[model samples]
Target: MISLTNLSYYLGSRALYENASMHIKPGQKIGLIGLNGTGKSTLLRLIMGEYQLDGGTISKAGDVTIGFLNQDLLSYQTDDSILSVAMQAFERQNHLQKRIDGLLHEMEVNYRDELVDKLARAQDEFAALDGYTIQSKAEEILEGLGFSTDDLHQPLRSFSGGWRMRVMLAKLLLQKPSLLMLDEPTNHLDLPSIVWVEKYILNYEGAVIVVSHDREFLDNVVDSIVEVSGAKLNYYSGNYSFYLEEKALRNEIQQGAYENQQAKIRQTERFIERFKAKATKAKQAQSRVKMLEKMDRVDAVIDENARVNFRFNFSTQPGRHILHLDDVTKNYGEKKILTHANARLERGDHVALIGANGRGKSTLLRIIAGTEPTTKGERRLGHNVSFSFYAQHQLESLNVEDNMLEELKSANPTKSEAELRTVLGCFLFSGDDVFKKIKVLSGGEKSRVALAKVLLSQANFLLLDEPTNHLDMQSVNILIQALDQYEGTFVVVSHDRYFVSQIANKIWYIEDEQIKEYPGTYDEYEWWMEERKANPVDTKTAAPQASSNSNGKLADKSEHNNSNGSVNGKKPVSANDEERKEWQRALKKATQQSEEFEQKIAGLEKQIKQLEAEMASPVVVADGKKMQAKTADYQRLKTQLDSVQEQWEDAMLEAEKLEKKLG
Candidate 1:
């Protein structure tokens, strides 16, 4: 267990958090949340011993290894490949292995008995730590984080800074310290990679502390959220969504208390004033004045969220079909994203677009929004359908030299300086933060700035792509409430399931170059997916139903045979057509088998992903032995999967050979 007593951090003259205290036992995943500059990152730095506390003492039992994913990527430095960068986490293993190697080189007979025993012990320790599998483990972590096979051999210096941050995260997870403190770990990850990381965090055995804007990941991973507000750390025992509901109730109670106290004070003052002029009531009046003076006051801050209700109004009533994209096709050179895709979006539809990473959910939205054009077919927007797009890469648009307040001023000319600061405060930016240049801001801070800009845009049709990317739980809740009350249309692409459930009323699922709509919230969509699994469509039966043939033509078997050619067991086709029929059957079988393998692979991949996400939590890396074991298991499973994949691939090759033989 780790405990801090009256911890405080001083920033110039102001204390970001004063006398704040918290605790962590074994195996509890926690999320540290606050507005931008509310000391979340500072708190993590304090815990990691990177910064000294201004006041109060921190207590920890013996060596508690901490793996921190700092917002800044300067900590993990190497000129090696991405794989080598991640593998650096196994430094201790590498050190021990080196000693073992040196020992092996020395002749055993030439060495003293004591030297021989020491060498043997060193080798045993290295093996027990699973030092032998470091290379494979590093490769697996890199691949799981969306690194391509080519990227493995590619030097880390060849990658951009954002990709370098991913490599940094991969190292932290590979190290698997007792306490894992992640600051916006998912910022650079795509949907599939995010999902993979989330799954990894879930199965992690040690304690975890995550600082993220992705609500769905928190709801799935963290058991609690610690919110920093009013220069204090407030602990909430719930996930991101839970914290929102709880905070809403808590805020309501606070508001009532303030109102009631003010009302009583006003009544007391009135009575004292009325009796002041009367001689007989003078004593009572004086007594009342004394009583009033002695009364304790209820101090309450104004609710910032109450201010920025930039009511988005549709400029024009769109057609019944607000958007129509028929047989839309797109490709980047030979890499096809969407092929023969079709979809329709109507006015007032709260739609969510979802698919695996790099599958073009955002690209399709861009195509719909006209930021990008489809290669073929047409995407038509209804008359006067105005849109406010929130790109996932919003931070890229920010001017690095501009301060927070300046950015806001530039984004919305009509917004007053005071009003912009208040709005920024509501999103967790306050005081000097408004003066901080964009270049020095954290990923989460940049995300908030973008979101704050979007809120002020006042567009009726909102298109958001991963809007909850770098937020802590508290900010996400505030956002959820804001979106829920929104009366206009929303078309968002997010992997944050909780946020999607709160705001989306319909879903656009992209699969096999098709956009499928699930006309409900995330919960309803999930339920529908479950139903489909429980009652899957029988391909053999559904095939005939889906086939289109003129009824007049079907009546003639001769014509049908000329087109399709029947099999011998059912009906005779062309002479010597058995091989061709068998080929078709094999293809069908392979398709089914491939789908099944993909599903299994998906499930395994999901679990692995959860493990990565859990690694980002504050709990998993907070305990020594537990973190070590969790990481050991992660490496072991990765190896098992690789071996299994090799076998699976071989089986598939055999199946393909048989298919060719039959043909």
Candidate 2:
């Protein structure tokens, strides 16, 4: 365990932490959260002794060991395989194994009793340390962090920065130090990897302190929240969601106390002003002045939540079909990214494309944007459709010499300076901050500028590839709000679950070399996926009788059968007349049931929307009891809606199978 006592740290003349105190307990999972530049990562370094604290103490037990996983480790390079790198954590066992090998080698040459005795002792220690299973342990950890078994043998220098970072993380986890410190661990992770890490951290035996902006990751992994604000560390004894609710209540009480203190001060000042000149009340007035001077002033609460208020508009209204891909085939050398994949994007569609790494999400985005050529396919854009693509690499396309304001001006030459400034302000660049040159901005700052430019592109269709990268929680929330209010169609690729859930109404994933669609929110899609995993469907047996042709039209099965009742060189059995009649009756009943389920689903959706509106009402929000009741009601309705939706989908599938059989 480690404890920071009255910690005070400064960067030049600016104080990053002033009298910030936090005691990390054994086996505790803590999340360090704050706005960018608030020194969340800096605190971790201070604890690691990389930086000298300006004041106070960081004390830990002499036996305690620490393992830090940071961005700086991304530059690590070696020819050794990642498996070897990770197995290096077992230093004692490795040394013992080497000793055992040396003793055995000596005995082979000299046949000495001493060598045999030494070899026996070394082997015993190695076995006690579980050295024999070290390689397997390293492999499991590396693969859990998203590496393939084959990738474990690749040279560490052969991987990219992000993948290398994962290797370093695997090494640290294998170390099993007393205290684990991770800075932005999820930044390079995919959704599945992130989930894996969360589960791993939850069951870890050691203490953990993570600095991350990922809300859902924090909610799932951390048991306590430590917020850095106003040069001090504020502790919350619960997860991120609990911190938000507790902070709200604390701010409400603080605001009231501040107002009351202000009122009291004003009254005392007025009394002093009126009675100071009078002979009878002069002493009392002077006493009251001292009391006013000595009173502790209550600090007003600072609102950290920022809202996006600018309107995102385009000049043209797109046609009903925004884009279409027919039998699209894309390949890079021997790698097949997409093979005969067909998909359509319509007007007003908000889609989130997500999956594990190397699924070609960005490649698909570029293909949709018409920037990447297809090996064999047709991509058609609807009438009046204008589009803009945003990605992390686009940051390099920015003019570093230009200031943020000038960059926005270049993005939209028609918008007035005032309008551009307002847009920048919504992105947290206000007043003179907008005058800073792009070259001087940090990665997060550059990301905000690029996002602002994309919003101002005046395109009805947007393709965003990892737009949430390098953004803080507040910035992510602001982008979500803007996207929520946007009427234009968009397909975004992101690994941030909370951001995707908030902005996207539809979910898309690549499976079996084809783009698959789920007509629901990310949360709903996740639930459906879980259901499928729990009760997996066998696609080989579930294939429908009718299939789509290259033109995306349904091909009749009868066309493939001969008049002699032979299909594809196989004999077809004929059903009895009564059986035929029974099949027809069943198909009719299934179709009607499917139709009824659709109507019920529609009604449930309407009711859920009404409940959402009610929960958002000002009156309900102001009353704690009423708000709680409304929230409970909303959750209940959502659960019901999910059940009904599942039922409806099953009914439709059943109807489809019956129809296919009859045809």
Candidate 3:
């Protein structure tokens, strides 16, 4: 167990934690939450001994091992293969294997009994640690974090910085320390990977403390919440949802007690003031004054400025049908994403697009916003349906040279500086912060700025991709409130279930190259799912009734297939014949694309191999310019190869689906 007993920590002259006490018993998953700059990361550092305590003690069991996921990506070995780095988690097992090998060599050379005994002991230790399964286990964790099988063999330096962090996280999980403390672990992860982390943490046996802005992640994984604010700690014995409910009740109770205490103090003060000069009442007045002084004062609860106040303003109302997708298909080269997917959105419909990572949730949003083109079929936006698209990397799109005020001003040139500053203040930026350059802001601050820009867009439709990616709980609630009251349509892709539940009146579940629509809130959809799962008999027979139509609208398969086939009262081309022709054309196209992608991928791979060989050659190493040129070519080819490979995989899936239909 790890315990913090009346601990105090400081950031310069500011007290981040003062007389804060908490305990982490075995298997307890605690979520550390606070506003930005409230020392959530600092407290974790203090626990890890990266910072010295200003006062008090943090005691832990002697055998305790801590695994902290620091934000720094520079700590991992970039020169090593991803798999090799992950396998380093089993350092003790590696040592045991080495000892066993040494003992075997000794036994062969000298034929000694001592060598045999040493070998036996080493082998036992190796088996005890499950050394043989270490590599597989490491790979499993890495795969869960969104790494491909091919990625495992690639050098860490080949990947981008965000992916490299995932490699570090994979290593940390493999280590399985006594305490697992993650600071914003989901920052770089996609929705699927975040879901995987949630499951992994829930099943984790060690004590866990996560510092995150993801409310759904906390709700799913953590059983306790430790809120750090105003140099104090407030503990809740439940998840984020429960914490909110309980905290509100507790605060209300505190307010009531404080009000009652203030009333008594006021009455006593009035009595003392009225009788202090009267000789008959002097003694009683004196007694009352002493009583007042001795009484334990009930301090008024201080409610922080925890939420941003704003509304999403729109210039015009959209037509009833906000957007429509008819037989829409999206693919990169041969890699198919959405295949014949259809959907329609009506005005005032707040839909959530949810699916696994790389399954085209964001891609679909991009398609609808006209930022990306559809590979096949059509997409139509309703009249007056102007949208503001907020991509996950919207912060990166900001001009680094521009200040926060300038960025907001760019969004709304007509708005005055005072008006822009007011909006920025709503997003927690004011005074000097508004003057700060966009480049120097932290992830949370940048996210707020991006949100502020979106708020100023005043578009009637919002296409937001992972808007809550770097926001705090408070900011999330603020956005939720804004969207809840907004009179516009939106299709937001977020892994935040709470935020989605709050805003989404309809859900578009994209899975298996198709979209499924559910008419109702996320909660209702979940309950319906649970009810279906509970009755296996009903579930088995319900599949045919729930298939989607040409427009991706939910319908009875029998009725939809028969009625929707005949358009404009014309006798439709035989459904099977049309389907067969389409599939045949798709198959031929996919096969040709797949072959072309294969050739490109092969060429790129060959080039990469040749470059690696040349880089390893002594002659090339001796020439810096030659080596640099080869390395650059190698990186460029590798990136192209990755894209081609993705396309090839998509083509293969499309081909398979076509073949199955043809058969």
Candidate 4:
């Protein structure tokens, strides 16, 4: 547990947090959120002790380990495998195992009784630590984060930067510290991997503090939301969705109060100016002036100037059919992505293209945008259709040598200097930001520049792929709203469900080299999927094409489990009865081992006590040799007792694991 009291932090002259106070309770999961440059990462650093508080105090409970997983990956041995790096989380267990091995070797060489006792004690400590589960836990976490079984044995240095960060994440999760701090954890994860982490955090036993721009992930995982805004930390009792509603209500109330106070102040000042010099009304005017002076000014509910306002401008309108694709097939060597895929889009259609990662979503978008050619496909764009594309790679496509203003001008060469400056200002780039070189800009800043270019292009059609990758939540919402109101037709490849749900009027679901069209919002599509699961169709027959109005029928139903299994329907043949039986057997064995260790420990304790009583007798103390011999026996019994006790503790820990798994 940690508490921040009257915390204050400053970045040069700008105040990040002033008198910001909050408490992170044990096992509480908190989502830290705010606009970009609002010090979400800085607060995590403060909790990690990377930054010294300028004023105030941060108190943490004693011996509470904190696992902080930042974006950077610390260097490791070049030959160390990924699994080995993750297993380093069990440093204590590793050391104890080594000591046990040394004692085992000593016993093998000399066969000393003391050596056996030492080895037993060491083995007990290692088992009590659940040392045997380390490798499995590491592998499980790595796989959950999208690493394959083959990746476990690969050297850590062989992974790319993003994958290396995932390795660090696995290490942090395996550490199982008292407190876990992750900043932008989903930045590199695919949709499925993100879902895995969401479920993992929800089931985690320790405290979690994660900062993420993915609204849906935060909404699903965290119990509380913390907003770092207006140089203060604000607490919300519920998830991100709750925070949004509460924040809006709070702002509305604050605005009303501020307006009322301003009105009263204006009335008092006017009375004072008009009647202060008069004799009859002077007292009332003076009293009003005093009241005005004592009144506490209510701060207006205006966000800081650092906010992005997005609106797309288009050059021309497209025909009724914005885009059409028939017999679309794309292949990379032997691996086929799309096989005779067919889709149609009308004017003003907002479509979301979603599927698992590496499923040709981005490739399809490129093919549609004319950036890439399909292997065997007939694609056509409607007359007067002009589109702009934004991808992850486009963020780096900006000319590093050019400043922000120059880049904007190049994108929209017809726009004058004044017009360009105004556009940049709306995107939250002003004054010196316009002069900032592309090479020196941060990731978020670079994203804003790239987006600004897309907006400035004024294309009637948009082909965007992961447009919200580097943008903060506020920026994402702004884009969502802008796209919602835009007249142009757009096809977006996005993993942000929240953003897609808000902007998309139709869904493009891809699976098994097929692109199926579902007409409805993302939320509606989710509902339809649940209905299909609840009333499953036979795989033996041909699958029915999902109707456009299917979403409307299931839209109002409650959320359902998407996991593969049978509940209210016929039993699924995929159930693993053998695996379940094996797990039960393991649990039973662990419990029996724990009971046996307890009995052995109890017997050792009794023997040690008897030996102590015998050595303490007055008859043995009077005889020097007898006393010395009794003392030696007492020491031997004590050593054996310690070993049994350790064994008992280890068995108990293993039993606990089994109990949880069984439950």
Candidate 5:
């Protein structure tokens, strides 16, 4: 457990935390959330001792161990083999094991009793730490993050930045510290790795605090929500989704009180202004004016103004035939990155390219974007095709010396200063901000600036590689809204499920080096997953691990620590009776606001039923236009109703399970 007692931090004239008090109990998963540049990362760094507090103190109950996965981990790279780096944590034990082995050899040769005793003590310590499971744990953690057996010996330099982040994650998991602080940890991870991290955190002992823009990720993995704003921290005893609904309701209530107070003040001011000039009620007027002047005005809180709405603008209409790939083969020496892959992309298609990390998702995106070529296949871009590529590693493309304005103009020559600045403003680049050099921007700022450039490209087709990286929640919402309205084609490789759900109309799932298409959003992909689970596929045997896992077979999940202080394989939480109880308790707390989530869901359900009944009624059939309108209304209602229904069911089950536990 960890505790913060009247902790305060100041940067120049601004105080980040003013006597902030917080408590984190064991077995609790906390989500740290706030607007960008609100010092969420700084607070974590303060706890991690990367920074010093200007006032107050952060108290600790005993020896506390902390591990952090910061955004600057991209620099952790080397030509050294992967396993060697992973085994570095066990150096002391390894050295002891080696010394014991040498001692045993010497004892056998010289018959020394002292060497035997030392060897016995070393073996005992090693066994106590679960040394036997070290290899299994290392392999499981690495593979869960999408490293292959062959990749085990590969040098760190072989990986890209995103993959390097995975390596950093592996190192932290290997350390197994008591307090794990992850700031936007999911930024560079693929879905598979994200899921693995979620599971690992769910089961991890001690406490976890993750800062992420992925709403669903935070909602599923975290138990408490810590909202830092206005130089203080407010704790909500639930996940991000729960925090959102609660905060919204609380704000609405506060707004009402503020409005009422303002109205009273206004009335008193009006009465005093009119009555002050008249001798008839001069005494009363003086008292009224005094009350108005002395009253402490209730300041209505306003939302953060930093949210922006920049989006890609498309000009050329996509051709019916957008792209074609036939018998494509891409290989790195003997290791095949892609093998005999074939696919076609049509105009106005919104596709998601999914696979385990390092399975060539970005490679295929680049190939489609025409950045590179396949070894044995033909790739074709149709006529009138104009596309933009948002690189997974975009920083490499930016010239550090170039200012924000220069960077935008360099991406596309046709953009005007006025037009470019107008668009850049949406990403919070304004006035002198546009003149700031790209190298001077922070990671989040650079990410937004890169995305701003993509929007100004005016391409009809977008090929994005993890486009949501470094974006805040508000920025992501703005982008999602833009994508929903834009009449363009997109092939986005992203791990943010919420982002994909809002805009993706089709999917191209890449697994085992093959691509499969689905006609709906990413949610439908889950149906495909369930089907595959019901009809299991033996991927290792069926395709020899050469082709992709098309059906997305059920992956085995397991967890254990080796005798030598190493965690074994990872596993998903099964939500048995006990686990379900925790979920229910959280749900119960979430539903206590004035406008209960259950009531909203019920109201929506009623509306949907009414709309369905009316649309189905024979009377509407007589008027073709009216019938069509009714049908459309019915469909819209059904979608909303379905979403509400899912939420309702989850909350009810969780509540029921917790109620029982409490009883």
Candidate 6:
């Protein structure tokens, strides 16, 4: 729907985009990605016409509508309820509703035919526009973005900045513009909300251009990738994973070309140097020199991946048991965060504490660090267990007047200046960058500095809270590598799935006011969670217990059961056999019913699509009677589709329950 050709933009003397060209086709999902300061957000503003382009043109269809969700919307405040704010997207319907209200009020006094006709026309138009269901649609989008139904009626000004950003996102989604641009949309969302948004974007009919550092989110939603690098917009035909492989191959080819070019130049220069003194070959040498000078040079590939070369070591090794929480009960006033929660951390445990927002992940991390007191619990640390807590607020603890090098020195006075500088360089702060004052650094820069100090603290146990916030993909990789190499135990709270998957060997989540542990990698954990969802059981009564296998690793108790109705070594009784047969029959019946319903739902959906197309035909539109008749048929098919979908859902749930019971 929009095309940018030979675009050039500059910030004073620095060129952000030079002759960059990109075409956004209709119904395309594009993920715009780059390291910080590569002009991703600036490009969004350039598209939105907030900034004047120095050169080239950005052309769009005259009727193309655009909706942009950016960080700037965080400052928007109003006394209207969030529901009302979201429903404001239906401008025409809202205005018509107001006029209808005015006409109806006039009818109470005058009762004229004109007023009655106006009200009838307005009502007809409202029904045709689906104005009556606008509020319900707004509410659905808002709730899908993580707002509770009760919170929808609250004043927009009462919410926090992140929540307000979600409200703006909901409003934009409701508007359903032809082209949507979102800047770091996942930054304000939790894991569940992010998943919801991914599904929504996958089914969205309009074009989408999203700027994000979230790899999994991009991989799941976008059909194409756009990399803003070296003042050019580079296109990739696939998602983030494909882009990584493709970029690596391209870099290999470029590096080889660059090397061959350099070698040729060196050989030519040597020839000129050796032959220029001889009178016979001087003319030939001059020609060779000119040829070398006129040759187009190949640009060397710049490696952007930052590596963590410095080893993270602790002064003292902790005991096998690093920490233990026994019957931990934590509360904030009337809110119960944790109730009788028990967990243990060993010296080698690499745990990821994850859940939705406001589930006490950070609070639990602080409690583990012994910085926050519990309502009723005992938190104990093992021998030689030195712990360091890292949180966003720790950035504020840094002395603003001190330079980065000085800050690291303050964190550990014993480390030599060379050692400190080496650590800083690993964090992408090289040479004179260490001399910059902390006050002048950006949020991501400050985060890197804080992370560097945390690594230098020489603590055997680390409690990290949202450590990946404000970090780019490369910086997150650096932190992941550093954590992977560290010999100490750590528990981190982060929403970045890629980082968590890279660093964590164990997963921890809060459910039913208690900490639950899953002993596996993130990918395995996700598979297990999906299986659990498909075969859901009552978690309160049938929680899976961890058991040790022959390899001495933790495995689920269900894995220990034998195939022939035996657990451990005992066989089931005759009564149990009859019960199993009954369950088997029930499962078979349920599966059959579910399959039948799915087929019916598919048929109804197909009929609905056909009716919709028929109703939209020019022949039907030209004849009012035919158009009305087709619309009625379309509505009838739509109602049938809805009913069939509900029944299919019920059948699926029933089949799942039966499967769970049989298992």
Q: Best candidate, TM-score-wise?
A: 2
- Model 4's alpha-carbon lDDT is 0.80
TM-score against native, each model: 0.66, 0.82, 0.75, 0.73, 0.75, 0.80
Per-residue alpha-carbon lDDT of candidate 2 for residues 1-663, written as tens digits (9 for 90 to 100)? 799999999888999999999999989999999988899989999999999999999999998999999889988899999998988888998899889888887888899887888888888889988989998899999999999988989999999898999998998999999999999898899999999999999999999999888899999999999999999999999999999999999999999999999999999999999999999999999999999889999998888999988999985555556777877888888778888777877779999999998788989999898889645787888655799999988999999999998999998998999999999988998879999999999999999999999999999999999898878888998999899999999999998999999998888777767777777789988888887778788632222212222222334767457567665323433567787688778878877886886787677668777887888799999999999998888788667765665565566656755555555
Say which prediction, candidate 4 or candidate 6, comes out ahead on TM-score: 6
Please tell me which model should have the higher TM-score, number 1 or number 6: 6
Per-residue CA lDDT of model 1 for 1-663, tens digit only, reads: 789889888899988978889998677899887666678888888988889888998887786878888757844456687887788798888888778777767755466776689788998888898988888888888888888888897887877666788888888888887888888777667767887888888887778998877767788889999888877878889888899899888888888888999998899889888999999999998998998889887667456453334442332333334566766789888878877666666657888777566678888878887878546877776533567788757689999999999998886777789888887876777688799999998777888888877766666577888887767655776677667766667788877777778888777766555565666677977887667768888532221111112110112344334445552113433335686777677767766675665566556566677776777678888977778877887787666554544444444645755554453
Alpha-carbon runs more than 4 Å astray in model 5? 78-80, 155-158, 271-297, 304-313, 399-402, 409-418, 537-663
lDDT of each: 0.73, 0.86, 0.82, 0.80, 0.75, 0.85
Error of 6 at 89 (Å): 2.4
Q: Model 6: which ten-residue window has the lowest total lDDT?
A: 543-552
Which tens-of-lDDT digit does each residue in 154-223 have in candidate 6?
9999998889999999989999999999998887888999999999999999999998878999999998
Per-residue lDDT of candidate 4, residues 155-247 (tens digit): 988876668888889989998899999988777777778889989999999999999989999999999999888898999989988988898
Candidate 3: where is the Cα deviation over 4 Å? 74-81, 99-118, 143-151, 154-163, 188-199, 268-296, 304-309, 373-376, 400-403, 416-422, 429-440, 528-663
Q: Note the residue pairs that clash in candidate 2.
A: none
List the candidates ranked by lDDT, beginning with the highest.
2, 6, 3, 4, 5, 1
Please provide, for model 5 over 1-663, each residue's C-alpha lDDT reduced to its tens digit, 9 standing for 90 to 100.
Answer: 677878888888888889887897877799998878888999998888889888777766586788899878888878987766776666666777787789878887798777778888988888887777776787788888888898888998888877777777887888787888888888877788888888888989878989999999998899999988878889999998899889888888888989999899888888988999899999999998778788887769777544444445653444455677766888867767767676766667778887666677888887887677546777787545688788747767888999988898988777788877877777766788889988888877888888777777887787888877888887787677667766777888888999988888777666565665566778877776777778788743332122222222322222233233332212233346877667665766745631365577567667766876786678887889989998888778666654655554455445644454344
Evaluate model 3: give its lDDT. Answer: 0.82
lDDT of 3 by residue, 164-212 (tens): 8888888889999999999888877876798899899999999999999
Give the clash count for model 3: 0
Looking at model 4, which ten-residue stretch has the lowest summed lDDT? 549-558
lDDT at position 508, candidate 1: 71
